[model samples]
Target: MDAGEASVVLEEISYFEAVLRMLCAMLVGIVVGVERGRNHRPAGMRTHMLVALGACVTMVVSNYLFVEFRPLGATPDPARLGAQVVSGVGFLGAGTIMREGLSVKGLTTAASIWAVACLGLAAGAGYYAIALTGAAAVYATLTVFEVVQRKMNVTRHATLALDLECKDLSGVMHDLNRFSVQQNATLSHVQFDETEERGVYHLTAIAVFRGANPQADQAVFLEKLGGNLNVKKLETTQY
Candidate 1:
């Protein structure tokens, strides 16, 4: 291209425009993070803000490279760089997920992190409407709609109090998680009480089961969980 065309391309993103995109990205991120922070999630306000800002910076740099190096016969794909951000952000999301005792936490936080990244990309790409709307939708899902569910008294899960006695403690939690998955149950809470007798420990947990027949599933869950030689006894009561 000629000098005039190259100059026009170079001036596409002025300093002001770049700053605006970055700031918008942060605003979008903050909007989404507020709900997470309020809920005491693993990835809170600052973490989401940083992820959004970093994604915006990445896009800005990509646009800059495309404009500056187009005159030098350099074939740089900005979308490729953006794709890296999409995939690479998964590691950050994975960091938020955690297993404690018998329960798993931070799935929602991980999803929020991914949503924040998308909002940042939208802001960076100058799609302000999409960014704002997406943030609003996420915020509503976290708050307003949740309140509606509570008011409506939606109880889709069947909670069960579990009593398990095991001789072998090793891999007990792992086995519990595996069997819960098999029975389509989620472990929300767990407690371990060891008796004076050696090699005997009591495992108690609240398992939320989801199925057409939760009561029937309970018996099957117990059978699978106690099938192991290490597990001596298992009982469950629906609540």
Candidate 2:
């Protein structure tokens, strides 16, 4: 067969291989995405599947270029495009993470996005073993680690931000101090802003709670503070 004919034959063969690789990548992505979805994570099934599929296709393209150009006295860098995929995936991962007041969310979801992208690259390169192993590892970390963390009474440190409006600032501060002592929570910071309204003070405090039942303690503290008639408005957030 002539060179052109031979090239056509190889291209046809590659098309079949590409289909398999893309499908494998998608499957792995779906598996990993499901675990995140169960937890109501932002980056779930569809997001993960797309990341994996994109990475896989990029790898296939890189490989194809290397093969197509190698015999034409061209030294092609197969890793060039794949390298881009690795770095480019970071932007997508960043989108999954978000911070609201004192609470930050989507860290695990971002991690999952990055992991699935790597798995896709592996699957596209025909490294089924690595891809499957990675998917399993990702799933385990998401599901099993959570159970272990909860069972071990892992202390999750969160920055508690409280906003209070009160006519009696001193009395409010005193009550907060008493509540902290009761809950064994530390007041890391306290700030006050004098509002334009007479006798109205905007008090902001940062509390750090560390214990087996910090969340429960926080709820109780809020309830107690809310009961005070002097406290006009109270808003709290766990960061």
Candidate 3:
């Protein structure tokens, strides 16, 4: 066969192979996304599937160019587009991380996103073993290991962010100090803002609680603070 005809035949074969590769990539993405979805993560299911599919397409295109341009003496790097997918996915991963109160959350979700993209590139490059293995790893980290992590977290001190709306600015700081001492919680990052309406104010702080029963301590803090006549509103977020 002529070089042109040979290229056409190879392209047809690659097209069929590419279909399998893309489907494999999509499957891995779905696997990773499902774990995230079960835990109520923001970047779940559809997001991960698309990332994987897009990365797979990129690698397939790169491979196609490398094959089609060989007769023209053009050396196209097959991994060039795949490398871009790895770095370019960072922006998308960053979107999954965020601050909730004093805690940094969604870091695992972000890393999973990046990993899923890599899985796509692997599948697109026809490395089914690596893609499948990586997906299994991601799923294990999100599920089985999570239970281990929770068990390990029992002795860890927890941080809580407190936002308070108070009816009186006068002597509230002393009252807050008294509350902190009573609860045996360390309170810091305190800031108070006053409003135009006299006596109305806001109080915010970071509270650190020790011991094994932080949930109970948090409940007590909420109950006591909420019951206070001086506290018009109280909000607490745990980390």
TM-score to native of every candidate shown: 0.67, 0.81, 0.76
Question: Lowest summed-lDDT stretch of 10 residues in model 1?
Answer: 153-162
Per-residue C-alpha lDDT of model 1 across residues 7-62, encoded as one tens digit per residue: 79668678888899889889878988877898889888899999888888888888
CA lDDT scores, all candidates in order: 0.82, 0.85, 0.84
Candidate 2 displacement at residue 114 in angstroms: 0.8
Q: 1 or 2: which has the higher lDDT?
A: 2
Arranged by lDDT with the best first, the candidates are: 2, 3, 1
lDDT of 3 by residue, 161-202 (tens): 988889866666677677666666788999999866688898
Model number with the top TM-score: 2
Off by over 4 Å in 1: 1-3, 148-155, 158-161, 164-239
lDDT, candidate 1, equals: 0.82
Error of 3 at 129 (Å): 0.7
Give the alpha carbon lDDT tens digit for every residue of 1-239 in model 2. 34585477457537778898899899988999998887788888888999999999998888777777766767778788878888899999899889876667888898889889989999888888899899999989988988987888666654689888998888988999999888768896699988898999999989887766888888777888899888998888767
